[model samples]
Target: MSRDTAGTAPASASAARTGTARTGTAWRRMRLWGLAHAVDDLYQGLVPAVVPYFVLDRGYGYVAASGLTLAATLGSSVPQPFIGLAVDRFALTRLAPAGVALAGLGLGLSGLVHPYPAVWLLVLLSGLGVAMFHPAAGKAAREAAGDSTAAMSVFAAGGSVGFFLAPVLATPVLVAWGVGATALFLPPALLMAFVLVRAGRRRAALAGAARPRTGTDRWAPFAVLTAVSVVRSVVFSGLSTFVELYWLRHLHASQLVGGTALACFLGGGVAGTLGGGRLADRFGLVRTVQLGTALTVPALLALRLTPGQLPPLLFALLAGAALNVPFAVLVKLGQDYLPTRPGTAAGVTLGLAVSVGGLVAPVFGLIAEHHGPQGVLSVLWAVPLLGVALGCFLVEPGPADQREPARTMDPAGRSR
Candidate 1:
């Protein structure tokens, strides 16, 4: 299928329905969607970055501060799958804009609202907005990339980049303008929402041209994929939350060293997410996932058991790669397992299923309180083995594995 996305303006629905309009879109649109994702997640990341300011500026206690996190998580992560189901049922493309806009608007309003519950409610609303953005945007990204995991990773990497950059982006503004500076973030979301609404209205031709050839919906395999994703999520959240503290407590490292180690872990994840797609493209998706799980075991165990301090940093990078190599692969695989409902697959992979780890994190915290952070790391070492066990239950993607050519052919029907 050829693409007709030379400019921002898309063809009319009538044109899309007729044979006149092109079926596919430009990769630039994926960039646009990716940018929208960054904007949505920037707010999600912004919450944590600003939470300290909320405490210092507003005199919030530890319990109050932690409650904000719970509110944000509950509002955002829990509703993702249901929101995804809504997107699949109605093909709710336009909701992406509303999500982004509300996310930004929530932050803006939070700055103006002085009361704690009101501010929490506003942030919760923002979380809801964040939840709304992923399913539909992910579904669109899947179509835009066709079946290319590398291309899909380009879309997913936006979130990682956003998360990595959030503190960088938010700190200076918060310092200069105070917590009310959250309002500054609103314009990007509002503008992006306007563009997405416009883009969604004109996607008829894009949808028609890029519709999947097969219409398979295998829930059983998708369930296995979700289970594997949950395990990966737990490991990722565990490392992200505790690795810095563990290094500081056990290795007797400075704050700088701990922060650097966390940075290494995250940087490895960004690299792994990009690399996983290429590995999947070459070897196959299921194989790629299994490889990640199998390799992750030793990496994590080494981080716990390595006698010296220096090797732990190397192990952190390896552990991050092993655990995250499946990030993009799992999203693509979920869609493959349920060819008819990419939106719902994206919802689980991108949303509620991943949050399952956060729920278990307190359990790890309890273990840490009793056995120390090293004990927490030791217990985490056993988690990846379950990923391998669940991975065995995954069936291969036959036709869904290669649904469409990655790039649209040129007007002359030659490869681009």
Candidate 2:
């Protein structure tokens, strides 16, 4: 019996060591994927930052500038589900790298070209590249993360950070070199693509094996979740566009204070994204999502009612955090709902659903015209109710509904 116990102890220790090593490797890969996501998304943020410069440098009219934005939006949002389907079918190993490269190239060249059509097309191509990156990177991140929501949040938060960084990073370059400084942004994308290629090769064996099949798909729940996501996006978009205006016009704050408010809100979103995953991991996904949706109502309401300039900033931060708590969870939940087609799930959740908010921005603009930014904020407090209501129908993916096959890529960048 002693001999038997001694023999089992060494084996158990060896197994423990092996498990620890794998976990470490997974984390390393997850961080790389997260950074790659940031690099890819930076270009998305750059578009809005670049648009104002195009008007300044090229003297484009409001219509033409809006057209350029429209081109990018159409390219990035429309074809995502189709692209996602392709990704699921073929598991395109180089898609993420190729997409990032294309995004950089398109945006970089937009400033160098003189013709409006040429600039528009280049921006369009950049948007397409963004469309390409999300599904593929999302799938890769998921495989690397396994079932760890906390790990997945790192990837999601990277995007928020990227968006936050873009205006900061590009403003100096654009100011120094004019719009042509967009070319400077290209190098980072290329560097990230190269890094991803190397990382993909090294981690091929580690992530290639298929995750055990956990359950079948549940479309109804996924549909409800998607609806909830759309509502969240609308509220987020409205706040992002109008928050500074709210501070400036309604609160009688200075431009610096207004800018600071926007920054604080975005920063809170990053924090909330990271915290959401941890919360979900501890409390269950659906519960965390519901909690977030419920919290948003009071946060936004408080922000709207707050009388002072400084006090509202606190509520703005809370509103941002509350609104974003479900952001990462929604992505993971979408994949879980349609376990057989993670790319499609990602495409809709990350791409199409989120983009819907931008479409609704004009509506909010009209509201602001009638009632001011404060009115817009007042309306936004009600949007989260839809999310909270829909969230009631969102069950945690049960054993019969939670399997996702691992997507594998060979060293040569081919799906195996």
Candidate 3:
């Protein structure tokens, strides 16, 4: 009996060790997934910052340039839901890297093309490539993260870092070597593709070995989350596209001052993305979201009323923080809603919902055009209010209220 007990003890310890190893491996994969997302976001951010310069230099007017920018955004945004659907049906690990490679090719090819129409067409194609990256990458992040809000926060921060880096890194390259050197990013893009492919293979191997139970019904809660995300995106769009111009034109801020203000906003977003995730984990998703959304009001009002540089600067910082904090929380909430369908939830929340803002950007532009840029802020002020109303309707998930379970069925009549 003593010998038999000792033998069983060894078996139990071996099993525990194996579990520990698997957990560590999964954690590593999650970090890799986040890094992959950051790389794609870096490339995405680079395009907008650099493309505008190229258009202007090539003799495109504000309208044409705006059209090109919108075209790229539409390219990136419109296909997300479809991509989300595709990820549900197909293997996404293979799709993401392929998309990144195509985007790299598109960017490189765009450099070879001239005429305005060709440029727009290439931008659209590049957008398609970008579209591929988000849903697939987001899905990977969710799968790798399991149910951890901290993991989601880390993943979301990768994109925020990418966004911050793009302008800072790409601007100098464009200034020094012109548009041609921007293609230098292609090699890094290819390298990222290679890394993701390897990671996918590793995940596949692990999945085969573990034979974890497959989950279902991940679509319902995403629809509501998508609506919430759209409101957030609108606010983001108002800030990203118009904030600098608004400050410069309305408040008589210099170009430098305007740019600084925008930087402050993005910096705040970086902080918010990481902090918001932690907040979500601690306070519950609904509370975290409400906190972020509620703060947007005062920030918006401050921007609207403030006169001096310091106050506006402070407002920009606070506004940026409020704007970005909910991004990861929403992604986590979506995952919670459809605990079984992490990728699908990520696709809807991160990919489709975020894109809606680009669709609505022109409306904000029109408002700015008519009422001055200040009107744009006034219009944007309504978004958070709407979000707050929506927040009231949001049903918190079980226990910690960290997860957002699916509340509806798909078009296929499958309950989520």
Candidate 4:
């Protein structure tokens, strides 16, 4: 018995060490993918930040400038479903690096061009590039993340971080060097692209040749989740578009205070995104999402009802956090529901449906114009209420729904 026990102890220790090492490696890969996600999304944020410079420097009117915005939006948000389909069909491992490069190059060259048509086209192409990155990168991030919602949130939060950093980083450069400074941003993209390529090779070498995907796709639940996501998007976009205006006009705050409020709200989104993932790991994906969606209504109502400047700021932070708690959860759940079509699932959840809010922004604009920011805020709670309703239909993916591990092949084509 003693001899048998001694032999088993070392073997158990070896297995434990192996598991720990694998977990550590998985996290490191997730961090790299997260950084790549940040770099890709930084370009998304750059579009809005650079739009003002185009108006100031090139003397473009609001209409022409809006066309530029439209170009980017149409390019990025549209066709993502198609791109995702292509990714799943072809296994496009190269798309991540290629997409980021194209996104950066298009934006970088847009400012250097002279014609309005050329600038619009470049921005459009840049948007297309952004579209290209999400599905492929999302699938890859999933492979890295496995079943951990917390790990996936790292990728999701990276996007929020990139969006947050864009104006901060690009504003000073644009102010100093005009729009031409956009050319300077290209190098980072190029460098990151190279890094991604190398990372892909290494991951492929470690993971080996891919195995056929396993699991059944559940579209009905995915459809419900999409509705929930769209509702979340509209609420988030509405607040993001008009939160500052709400502070300035309704709360009677100064421009600086308004900006600060917006900052607080966005910053809370970052924190909430991270927190939601952790919560999902513990409380479950569907529950976390439902909780977040339900909480958003009260938080937005509180933000609207709060009278004092200081109190509203707190509520804004809460509102932002509450609304975003499902942001990453939805993405992960979409993949869970459609395990066989992760790229397509990601394209719809991350790119296509989320864009609905942006398209719906004009309606919110009309509302603000007619009823003021407070009126817009009043209507926003109803949006998430609908999300809460839809979320009730969201069934968690079962253990059998989990994806099978990929089979690795040696250079000689033998399974390892």
Candidate 5:
């Protein structure tokens, strides 16, 4: 070979090594962001897990428990879109730490507060903290993951792990010490909030975004996606809110059995969220979502109708996986559908839109009050089928999208 060719080969090899190093560094950062996401969401899961305690120990009525759920749900979700819009204009990266800390602190105070109204206020504060974290953290995770659905899956799985851990970990402390044990759950959030504060110092994907597109909003697809997401929130949130009660009253189960049931469902969700990303990457995002939605009906049916506790518990795992596999993919798809406003997209999909389910939760409270917890759970069997019909209306972005750049940032944002 010529001397020029030999020299060029070494130079190319060096460039490859440097590129690989940068990618590796980015991935490590992404994992850390995932850890932050998990800790932030831990407080969210804690709200539901602690609900049973309020009902059983404190002798709170279904309406009162539902009111607490509404406060937390609305607090965490309603402010998200506005926060996303604000962060898009100016990166309030610090909001993430503040949000997590607020979530932890408010929840910690709940057990200490005596008045019912004050306790409700504390839960709302915690939910606001959750709302604060997602828009900023999600944009960071999107950048750090660099459009790798598998990496996004890892990030999404973190939240699932948090939700799964909430019941498993909280059940013991809560059972032993009552709702006042909420104070002990503060440490992880406090510590992680500091972790996020430091991590936010890193340059995020929004830093290297492309210029904004002037194209019209893709409201058609977005509306469909929102509808589907709302369905998911209702079913999943309903389950989280009621599953422990369902086990205790319906199946005559023990506390350990109850927590384990929740864990099985959420554990399945973690796996599904991770695997769903790969499935989306491999089979196409829309197709994978279709399968997941279709399966949700059968799994939930079996879970609801199964005679024995072990059998129903096993079905909960299936139901969790079938329902949640599309979640991370749906988030990514929303970014694609509205490429110009990815922050708003992230906010709606992650926060406001998803919270709609929680809005309807009081209806379930009424059902539980009148028809009982079994009736409430049984009614949810119809929700997944609606998701399926909605899925049918969604049009994929197309095969050409696979080879295009994955980062959903604008050129103007990238310059920052």
Candidate 6:
């Protein structure tokens, strides 16, 4: 009887110790993930706020400025698919931190350079860093969340918060200190790298503990979902790039009001991200995405028609709520469709979707130039319409057949 008691006591103590260790590790990893996301947010926000000013102030032509922005976006996006592939093939543990460090170095150097050509080159390099970081980090988030929808939503919210904070922090710095002040971002970037490195080591130690279950091939559903993501991306990009200017120019809103509106949109996104994840867990990913997409059309149309602050504000809030929910669910869907290649799913959803939006920006810019900024809002109506159409075709995968095996592996050795 004493022997039995002693064995049980040791086992119980071991389990408790293991649980404590896991909790500590999870906390550290979450912090690291948030930090990395913040770094991406800071740079993404800094570029748009400062880059145009830098070009105009420096006497570069509008064409040149546009080119620079396009180059940076292209650089950021083009490598993502490859990065996603690499994350799946090689495992993301070490590469994730390295990618963040590279992005930091690229962004830090962008400030040091002066010539327009040099700046463009540096932007391209920084884009590479952004491309590499996203897939790996997204994969880590999914793994950390243990494929739980609520957990993934919390993880996704980190990026939205980062996005919301970036403009608030970088805009003032850029306005006061100019683009050169971007150097300040380096320390945080480096700190995040260190944390990620430690996290990577821990992940590596635990790599063989549990093999992920095999997934299935559901190409028809994935194709439809990808189309929906593309449409969502288009709307998000338009709002991200033009919402402030639109309010100021069209509605006679002050710069402060315009900024506030932009903040509200992103803040709403942060709320939607968290809320949507919980909703997805309780209701199912398809239901959550469908409901969100369905609401988006009316919200966007309202934004176009509403003239007053109150109405537009309400529209913005609803639009944000609708627009943002799809992001977390889409990521979840990608993973479910290609369960064995969670990283790839992340790349396709987060990386490629954003890229598609970036590609669509010039078209919207043309519409803005031709039809005026308010007219640009009209273009956004198409996004949700397309999203709704595509979403109807999205079919949830079954448990034993989670992912489409063929599409899961990228033929190229890159990760998204």
Cα lDDT for residue 172, model 3?
62
lDDT of each: 0.74, 0.79, 0.70, 0.79, 0.81, 0.70
Candidate 2 lDDT tens digits, 73-147 = 677788899988998888487888988888888988888999888998998898888888889888877766667
| lDDT computed for candidate 1 | 0.74
Off by over 4 Å in 1: 1-29, 46-69, 107-120, 168-187, 201-213, 247-259, 304-313, 368-375, 401-416
> Candidate 1 lDDT, tens digit per residue, 81-111?
7898898778565788999998889866787
Please report, as a residue range, the 10-residue window in candidate 6 with the lowest summed lDDT: 407-416
lDDT, candidate 6, 1-416, per-residue tens: 69999899999999999767754544444555655776665565555545544643566543454455566578777888888888888765766667667666777677777887788787777767777888888877766555556666656776777667755665566557667876777776677778777756655645655455475656677778888888887787677666765776688786456666666677788888878887887788898898888888888898889878556877777788889887788887878887777777788887777656766666666776677568778878767877787787787667633432321111111111
At residue 119, what lDDT does model 1 achieve? 93
lDDT of 3 at 415: 26
Query: What is candidate 5's lDDT per residue for 1-416, written digit by digit as tens?
Result: 99999999999999999767854654464667678778888888887888888888788888899888888988988898899888667768688899989999988878776688998999999989988888877766665565567777777778888888899889999999999999998899889987776655543544445344334457799889988988999998888888888998889999889888888888888888878987988888889888998998999889899997788998889888988899888887777777656677878887777666888889999999997788888899898889999999987764334434434432113321
Question: Candidate 4, clashing residue pairs?
Answer: none
The clash numbers for all candidates, in the given order, read: 1, 0, 10, 0, 13, 17
Q: Write the per-residue lDDT of candidate 4 for residues 1-416, one digit (tens) a residue.
A: 69999999999999999767854654565777778878887787677567657866998754565566567768877888999899888857689899899889999899999799999899889888888899988887776676778878988887766665665677678778889998988987898899888766766655535665689899999999999988887887677656766776788886557656766776687788888998998899999999999999889999888888878989888987888899889999998888888889988887777766666666766676678778889888888878888999999997833668445332222333
Residue range with the least summed lDDT across 10 consecutive positions in model 3: 407-416
By lDDT, the candidates rank as 5, 4, 2, 1, 6, 3
Instruction: Identify the leading candidate in terms of lDDT.
Output: 5
Model 1: pairs clashing at backbone N, Cα or C within 3 Å: 23-209
Better of 4 and 5 by TM-score: 5
- Runs in model 2 with CA error above 4 Å? 1-27, 47-70, 108-120, 171-181, 203-214, 245-258, 307-310, 368-375, 400-416
- Where model 3 places Cα greater than 4 Å from the true spot, the runs are 1-29, 51-63, 107-113, 174-181, 210-220, 247-257, 308-311, 399-416
Score residue 127 of candidate 5 by CA lDDT.
89
Q: For residues 115-231, write the lDDT of model 3, one tens digit per residue.
A: 878877877776677788877777666655656676678788877776666656665666576666667777766888898787666566444232222444445555666777888
Please list the residue runs of candidate 5 whose C-alpha ends up more than 4 Å from where it truly belongs after superposition.
1-29, 204-217, 398-416
TM-score winner between 3 and 5, please give it: 5
